[model samples]
Target chain A: MDAIETNSLGRRFGDVNAVESLDLTVQKGEIYGFLGPNGAGKSTTINMLLGFTPPSSGSGTVLGYDLEHESVAIRQSVGVLPEDFGVYGRLTARKHVRFAIETKGADDDPDDLLGRVELADVADRTAGGFSTGMKQRLALAMALAGNPDLLILDEPSSGLDPNGAREMRAIIREENERGTTVFFSSHVMEQVEAICDRVGIMRDGRLIAEDAIDSLKDRFDADSRLVFTLDTVADDIVPALETMNGVTDINADGNDVSVVVADASRKAPVIEAVGASGVTIKDIRIDDSSLEDLFATLTTGERPTSRHAEENAANTTQLIREADQ
Target chain B: MSWVHVARKDFADALRSKLLWVLSALMILVVAGISAIPQLLYIPGQGPAPGFDDGMSFMFTWMTMMVSIIGLVVGYRAIVGERESGSIRFLLGLPNSRRDVVVGKVLGRATVVAVPTVIGFLVGAVVILALYDGFAVTDYIGLLVFALVIGLVYVSVAVAVSASVNTRAKAVGGVLGIYLIFDLLWWTVPMAIYWLLERELPGSTDLPAWYVLVERLGIWEPLGILSGTLVDIAGVETVSTADRLAGDVPFFLETWFAWVIVIAWVAIPLGIGYYRFNRAVMS
Candidate 1:
C-alpha cells in the first residue's frame, strides 16, 4: 500500500497558484525526495499533505487517512521537521522531546531519541541558548518522539555546516533503513542526490519530473558532463566541440573547454583533437549529472518542461561509443 | 488531556523566558509600590483616601492593573510570537487541533498571570487592611475570581490577535492599541455624555443614551470591573468627584459589563484566530 497518495492536490492564495493538480504516491519504507526552487510550491504541497492547509481542490490519503477529514489522525502518525525548526527555549532538550512524546501519547525514552540526534550531552540545558544546529537537532529529536512511520523533512540542511549537513544525511539514511517512509524536500541538490531513493522535481507549482536518481540522469541525456583543464590556448575549440557528432553541447572558459559527449569513447578522440591542435591537456574529468544537473536543466527552462528527460537519459545510458580511428 | 500537556509546556517555556519574567516582575513592583504610596504620604485630615473603607477597594485596583499589564505583556505574544519565530508550524504539525492550542494558551497564560496577581493582591490587601482596619472574605474571593477571568479574557483576545498577525511586534501593538482605546473611551465617553446631558438639556430627568453607553462600557473594562466591584463590596459610602470620575468608570466597566464584554472579546477573536491558524502554512 502506498504510505502517502495525493490525487490532483491543489492550493491557491488569491490568484497565485501555489501548487496545481499535483499527484504523488510514496510507498512505505522508501525515501522520497522533493526537489524544487525556493517558491515552486514544494513547502505548500507538504503543508497540504499534513493538513495544515486545506487543498483548494482534489484530495489525498496519508497512512490510509483522508487528507481533509482525517488530518489529525494523519498528523498523529507522521513526524515533521519543518524548514525552520524551532523549540521552546524554556525547556531543556530532554524536556522538549518528552513533551512531544507525551503530546503524541507515545511511549519512548526521550534520552534515546536525543542521544540519536547527538543532543544527549546538553539534554538538561535550556534550549534558549542553543545554536541554530543544536535547535535543529532538538526539533528532530522531538519529531522522532512517537517513532512515527513517516518523516517529512523540509530543507533539513539549509542552516547547517558541512559536517552538520553530512550528519543529517546519515541520520535520514539510517531512518529509511529502519522502515520509515521519508519525504524530504530541499533546494540543495547534493543532499537529495546523496540520500533520496526516488525524487520528484517541482517547478512553477507543478511536478515536472519524478523517478529514481539514475533514471532521471539517464532520461535527461545528462549523466556525463565533459570537463577539461588544458594548458594550451584554443578559442576555436568551443565552437569545434559544439559541432562534433557525439557532443550535444559545449561550454568553455579560455583553454578549458567542456564537451557534453553522448558517448564515453568520444572522450579520447576529443582530447586527441585538442592535442593535435597543439593544445596540451593537463586534466580531464567526466562528471555525471547527478540529480542537481537534471534539476537545473528542467527548472531553468532551458528545455521544455516534460517527462521526456526520463526517456532520453535512460535510452542513452550505454557508455558512449568511442570515436572511430 | 493534550491541552494540559500543552499548558505544561507553555508554563515551562514561560518560566524559561527571561523577557516575560522580567516584565511580570517589573509590573508587579510598579503596581505594588504605587499602591502603597497613599499610606506612606498620607495627610492627617484629607484622611485615608476619602473612601478607603475596605481591602476590596485597594486589592481590586492592584490586581486588575496587574492582570491587564500581564495580558498585554505575556498574552499578547501567545500566537504571534509562535508565528514570528516559525514555531507555530511545528506545534500545529502535531495531532492537536487549533481549538486545543487556543484553550491551552489561554489557560497557561492565565495561570501565569493569575498566580502573580493573586500573590500581589494578598500582600497589598493585607497591608491596606492593617492600615485601614477593614477586611472581608467575600471581597477577597470575588476579587480573585474576577482577576482570573479577566486575565483569561485578555489572553484570549491577545492570542487571537497574535494568531491573526504575522509578527510579534504587530501583535504587541495591536493589543496595546486595543487596551488604550477602550480604556480612554471607557472614561472619556461617559463623562462627555454626562456633561452634555447636564448642560445642553436642562430638564432631562433620565440618564442620556450616550452616558448609559459609557457606563455600560465600564462593566466590561478589565481595570474598571475589579475596582468597581471591590468598592461596592468594601461598603464605601460615596466616591469623591475626582476618584469617582477617574476611577469609578473602570470600576463599573469591571463589575457590570466585565464578564459579557470580556467573553465577547475572547470568543470572537479566538474564533477568527483559530480559522487563520488552522490554515496557516508553516514556512
Candidate 2:
C-alpha cells in the first residue's frame, strides 16, 4: 500500500484557494517531490497532511489511516519540517531535540539526533543566537527524532547555503534509503530532480503534473536548447527555424539565435541546414532540458498545454476556486 | 505526565534567564518599601477615632495592591511571550494534549509568581512584627490565602488574555486594562453611584437596585476577592467563617454568592483557556 494517498484534497482561506484537488500517491520508501513556485499552496497541502488544519474538501489516507478520522494518528506517525521555522530560539539545541523526542514518545537519545545533524558542537548554544542554517539543521534534527515512517519536509533547504543544502539533501537521501517515505516540497528544480524519485508539479494550488522525474522530463519533452552564435544577421532565420520539424521555438537577439527543439540529437541537422543557407556560424552549443526547464515550463502553463497535465492543472485549479466560493 | 516535563523545562529556562531574578528582586524591594507605610505615615495606636484599626486597614490596602501588581506582571507573559518566541509551537507539537500545555504553563508560572509573593509576605510579616504589632494566626492565614488566590485568579485571567491575543504587547495591554478597569469598578463604582443617589433621594430612598447588581458584579472580580479576604482578616463584617464552612447546606448554596462567583472566576475561564489551547494551531 502507498504510504500516502491524497485524493482530490482541497483547502481555501477566505477568498483565497490555497490548495485544490491535490491528488498524490507516495509509495513507501519513495522520495516524492512536490514542486511548485512560491504561493502555489505547497505549505498549505503539507499543513493539511500533517493535520495542522482541516481540508476544505475531498479525502486522503496516510499510512493506511483515514485522513478525516485518523488525523491525529497521521500526525503522530509522520515527521514534519514546516516551511515556517518551528524551532524555539530560547532553548538549546539539545533541549529542542529532547523535547521533540519526548513529545513523540520515542526512546531516541537527544545526543544522537544532535550528532546526526552535526549540531553536537553547538548543542549548548541557544538556538536564538544560531545562524539560519544551524536553525534549519536543528529543525531537521527535531523532525528526525521519532524515526517516523513518513517525512514531510517543506523547503527544508530554504535557508541553507549550498553546503548546508547539500548536507540536508544527503540526510534526506539517507532517511529515504532507510525505507522512510520522503515527501519534500521545493521550488528549486535541481534539488527536486536530484533528491526525489518521483515529481509532482503544482501551479496555482493545483498539481499540474505528477510522475517519475525522468518520465516527466520525457512527457514534457523538456530537452533541446539551440545555441548558435551568428556571424551576421540572417533574415527569415526564425521563420525557417519555426518551420523545421521538432523545433519548438527560436530565440533571436542582436548577434545570435538560440532555437529550442524537441530533441538535442536534431541539433547537427539544424546546424547543417543553417550552414547550408550560407550563414557563417561562429560557434554552436546544444543544451539539454533540465529540471529547471521542466519547472519553468510547468509553472508557466506552457509545456503541459498539449498533454494530460494541462487539463489536470486546470481541473485542480478549478476545484480549488470553487471550494473557495 | 508530560506536563511535568513541560513545567520543568519552563522553570529551567526561566531560572537560566537573569531577567527573572532581576524582576523578582525588584518586586521584593518595591513591596518591602510599600510595607513600610504604617510606620512612616500612621500615628501608633491613635487616629481620628479612638478605637479604629488603622494599622490593619493600612496593611490590607497596601499589601493587596502590592500582591496584585506582582500577579499582573508575573502572569502577563505566560502565553503571549511563549507564542511570540515560537516556544509554544515546540511545546504544542509534542504528543501531549493542549490541556497539558495550558495547565503546565499556568502551574509553572504560578510557581514563579508564588515564590516572590510568599517570600515578600513573610518578610513583610516580620517587618510588621518588628516595626509595629503584628496580627494573630488567623490574619496571617487570611493574608497568605488571599495572596495565593488573588495571584491565581489574576494568573488565570492573564492566561485567558494571553490565549485571546496574538502578541505580547497586546496581552500586557489587555491584562493591564483589565486590572485598571476591575480596580475602578469594584472599589469606586458602587460607592460613587451610592453617593450620587444619596444626594438626590435623601434619607427616604435606598441604594439603587443597580448598585446591588454592581456589588454582585464585584464578586466576579479578582480584586474583590483580595479585598473581601482582607476585610475578613482585618475584622470587617462581610461574612463569617461559620457561614462559609457550613456543611448542612450545599457548599455553593451556603456561602455568600460572592465566594461562589470567585471560585467560578478561577475555574471557568481556566477551562475555556485549556479548550482554546487544545484547539490552538501551533506552527
Candidate 3:
C-alpha cells in the first residue's frame, strides 16, 4: 500500500487557493522529499494530510485510512513534526516524549528517544530556556517516540547548524533504514538530494515535478560546460568545436575557450577538436550541472540562481563598464 | 482514555503554575478572615451574634466571588492560549481528537478551581465549629457541597467561554461579562421584567406568574441558586429581597430544585461548548 495518496486534494483560505488539485503518491519505505519555495503550499498540504486542516475539495488517505473521518487512526500510526510546532515551556524533554508516548499508547522509552536526539544530558531541564535548535531536537525526539509506521517531517533541518544538519540527515537515514516511510519537506536542495530516494516539488499550490533525483536532472536536460585555458587564442578552434556533434555555444575570449556539450560523453571529442587546432592547452575544467543547478532551472526556468551565476553576472557587468571607460 | 491522559498532564502542569498558587493563598486568607469575623467584632446581648450558619453564608458569598474569579483565571486561556502559542499543533499531532482537547481542558481546569475551593471550605468548617457553641456537621457538609457545586458552575461558564472564543482577550472578556451579569447584575434582570409588566398592564394585584417567572430566572445565577439552596438545606433564610419580594416562595425555588438548577449550569454550557469545540478548526 502507498504510504500517502491524495487525489486532487485541495484547500482554500478565503479567496486564496492555498493548495489546488494536488495529486500525490508516496510509496511505502521510500524517503520522499517534499520541496517547494516559500508560500508554495507545502505546509498547507502537510496540514491537510495530517488532518490539522481539512481540505476544501477532493479526497486523500494516509496508510489506507480515510483522511477526514479516520484522522485519529491515521495520527495514531503516523508521526508528525510540524514546521511551526511549539513545546510546553513548563514541560521537560522527557515529559514531552512521555506525553507523546502516552498519547500514542506506545511502549517506547523516553530516555532512548532523547538519547538518539543527543538530548539525554538535559532530559530533565525544562524547554523554556532551550535554544531554537535544541527545541527542534526535542520536537524530533517526541515525534520518534511511538516507532510509527510513517514519519512526516516539515523542514526538519530548520534552525540547525552545519553539524546539527548532518546529524539530522543521519537520523533520517536511520529512520528510513528501519522500514519506515519518511515524507520530508525542505527548501534545502543539498539535504534533500543527499537523503531522498524520490522527490516531489510543489510550486504555487501544485506539484510541478515528481521523480528521482537523477531522473529530474535528466528530464530538465541539464548539460555540462567544458572550460579550457589555452596558451593563445585560436580562430579555427571556435568554428571547429561548434561543428562537432552534441557541441554548441562555443566561445573564445583571449586565451580561454568554453563549450556547452549535450552530455559528458562528448567531452573527449571536444578535447580532440581543440588539440587539432594546434594551440597548446594549459588547463582543462569540466563543470557539470549539479542538482542545485537543475533545481534552479526547473523552478525558475532561466538563468541559474546559484552563487556562480550571480558572480558571473557581476563579472560580465564589470567587463562592460571597463569597455565603456 | 486520550482525554484522561490530556487532562492528567494539564492538571499536573497547572498545579505547578505560580498563578494557581497565588490564587490559592488569597482564597485561604479570605476564608480565614471571613470565618473570624464574629470573634473579631463582638456585641454583648446580641444573642450569640453570627453563628455557624451566618458564618457559612458569609463565607459562601465571599467564596462564590473568589470562585468566579479563579474560574476565569484557570479557564480563560485553556484552548485559545495553546492556539496562540502554536502548541496546538504539537497537541493535535498526537492521536487526540478535537473533542478530547475540549473535554480534557474543562476537566483539568475544574480540578484547578476545585482544589483551592475545597481547602478554603475545609478551613472555614474548622473555624466555624471552633468559634460557635453549637454547630451541625450536616449543615456544614451541606454548605460545602453547595459551595463546591456553585464553584463548578462558574468553572463551566469560564471553560465554555474559553472554548467558544478564538482569542485570549475575547475569552477573558466573555467570562468577565458572565461574572458581571450573573454575580453582580443578576437581580436587575427580574426587577426589569417586573417593571416592564407593571408599566404595560397598570393593575395586577395577583401577579403570581410574574413572581414565579422571576424566581425561575434566579436559577441562571450561581449566587441566587447558592442562597436559595442554602436556605432549604440549613433552614436559614439568607435569600436576598428579590426572592422574598414575591411574598411566598414558588415550588421551583425550593432547595431540592435549586440543586437541579446548579447541576444544569454545569451541564448546559459544557454541552454547547463541547459541540462547538469539536467543530472548530485547530490552527
Candidate 4:
C-alpha cells in the first residue's frame, strides 16, 4: 500500500479553503518532498494527514489505516516532526525523547536517539535553553523514536544552519535507506531536490505537480536555451537558425546570438549550422533548469531569471491558473 | 495506561518550575503554623488553655482555602500553557488521544496540590502532637484526606477550563470567573433566591430544604458538609444539618449525598472539558 493516500481531501476555515480537494499519494520507502510556498496549504495538508486537523471533505489513509478514524493506530507506527512545535520548556532533551518513546510504547533509549540527532551532549539540559537549531534536532530525535515505519516531517530543516540542514538530510536519507517512508515538507527547493525520490508541489491548496526530480527537469528541458557569442552574426543566419528543427527563436545583438530550442537535442545541430555558415563562435553557454527554477515556475507562476525558464513559466502559469479555477 | 506516562511527564516538568516547592512551603506554614497558633496565644493564667480541638479548628479553616487556590494555580495552565507555547503539537502528534491529555493533566495537577498538602500535614502532625493535648490520629488523617479531595475538585475545574479554551487568557478568565462565582459569591445565590421567594434574606436556622439545597450547589457547600463528617472535630463547623433546615434533613442534604456532589464537581467539569477538547482542531 502507499504510505499515504488522500482522495479529494480538503479543509476550509470559514470562507477560505486553506487546502482543497487534494489528492496525494506517497509510495512506501520513498523520500517524498512536499513543497510549497507559505500559505500554499503545505502545512495544512500535513496537518490533515497526521490527524492534527480534520478534513472538511473526502477521505484518506496512512499506512493502510483510516486517516480520520484510525489516527491513533497510524501514529503508533509513524513518527512526526510537526511544524511550529515548541519543546517543553521544563523538560530535558532526554525527557522529550523519552516522552515520545513512552507514548509510542517503544523501548528505544532516549540517549541513543538523542545521539543520532547530535543532541546527546545536552541530553540532560532543558530544551528551552537550546538554540533554534538544537531545538530542531531535539524535535527530530523525538520524531525518530520507536524507529517508526513512516516519518512525516514538516519543514525539518526550518531553523537549522547549512551544516545542520545537511545533517538532517543525511539522517533522512539514512532513515529512507532503512525502508522507512519519509514525507517531509519545505518551501526550500534545494533541500528537497538533493534527497527526494519524488516530490509533490502544492500551490493555493492544490497539488499542482508530482513527479521525480529528473522527470520534472526533463519536462522542463523542452525550453532549453543555447547562447553563442560570435565574431560576426550574419543577417541570414538569424533567419536560418530560427527555421531549423526545434528552434523556436533566434535573437542577435552585437555579434551575440541566443537560440531558444524546443529540446536539448536541437542545441548541437543549431551550433553546427552556425559553424557551417562560417560564423566564428567566441563563447558558448548552455542554461539547464534546476528544480529551484521549476518550483518558481510552478508555485508563483513567475518567470525564472535563467535564460530559458521564461516560456515554461508562462505555460505553467497558464496551466496552474486554469487548474486553480 | 498512557495517561500514566503523561502524568509522570507533566509532574516532572512542573517540578522544575519550583511552584511545587513554593506551594509546599505555603501549605506547611498554613497547616503547621496555624495549628500552633492556639498554643502560642494561650497563657498559664487563662481560664482554660486552648486544646487540640482549638488548634485543629483554627488550621482547618485556612487549609481548605489554601488547597483551592493551589489547585487552581497549578491546573489553570496545565493544558492551555502547552497550547500557548506551541508544545501541544508534540503532545497530540504522538499516539495520545485527547482524553489522555485532559485526564492526565487533572491527575498531574492534582498531585502538585497533593504533595505539598501531604508534607504540610505530616509536619503539622508533629507540631500539633507536640504543642497540644489529645491529638486524634483519624481526625488528623481525615483532615488530610479532605484537603486532597478539595484540591482534586478545583484542579478538575481549572483543567476543564484549560482544555475548553485555546488561549491562556481565556483559560485564566475562565478559571478566575469560575472561582469567583462559585467559591466566593455562591453563598449569595441562595440568599438572593430566598429574598425573591420569601421577600426577605435567609435566616441562620429553620430555613426551607430547598433554600439550603440551593446553597449546597455552591462549590464548597457539599465539601463543607463533608468536612463535618470527614473530620468530625467538635469545634469545626459543628452545626448539625437538622438544626438549620425547617424539618428533617432531605436525602440530598444528607452528608452521604454530599460525597456524590463533591465527586460530581470533579467528574462533570472534566466531562464537559473533554467534550470540547476532543472536537478541537489543533491548527
Among these predictions, the greatest lDDT belongs to 4
Ten contiguous residues with the weakest lDDT in model 1 chain B: B201-210
Please tell me what DockQ candidate 3 reaches: 0.62
* CA RMSD (A), model 3: 6.3
Question: Candidate 2, which segments miss by more than 4 Å at Cα?
Answer: A64-71, A218-222, A227-260, A263-284, A300-325, B30-57, B125-139, B186-210, B219-232, B235-256, B267-283
Summarize candidate 3's per-residue lDDT along A51-99 as a digit string, tens digits. 8889999999999999999999999999888888777888888988899
lDDT of 3 at B10: 85
In candidate 4, what are the lDDT values of residues A1-325, reduced to their tens digit?
9999999999999999999899899999899999999999999888888888999999999999998999888888999999999889888899999999999999999999998888889999989889998999898898998989999999999988999899999989988898899999999999999999898899888898887877776767666777888887546579778779988767677778777776788888988998898778889888776667768778876666756566466447544654456
- lDDT tens per residue, model 4, B154-209: 99999999999999999999999999898899999889988988898778999999
For each candidate in turn, the TM-score is: 0.79, 0.79, 0.85, 0.93
Model 3 scores a TM of 0.85
Better of 1 and 3 by TM-score: 3
Computed on C-alpha atoms, the DockQ of candidate 2 is 0.32
- Best candidate according to TM-score: 4
> What is the C-alpha local distance difference test score of each model?
0.71, 0.70, 0.76, 0.88
Candidate 4: what is its chain A TM-score? 0.88
Off by over 4 Å in 4: A226-259, A268-285, A304-312, A315-325
Alpha carbon deviation, residue A66, candidate 2 (Å):
5.0
lDDT of 3 at B48: 62
DockQ winner between 1 and 3, please give it. Answer: 3
Residue B148, candidate 3: C-alpha displacement in angstroms: 2.6
Residue-level lDDT of model 3, residues B1-283, one tens digit each, is: 7998788888878865776677767777777678678666788777766666666656656766677677777888888788777788888888999889878888888888878877876776677778876677776666666656656677777888777877889888887787677656776776667677676532233445455455455434535555554544343455443444435655565545656776776778778777777667664
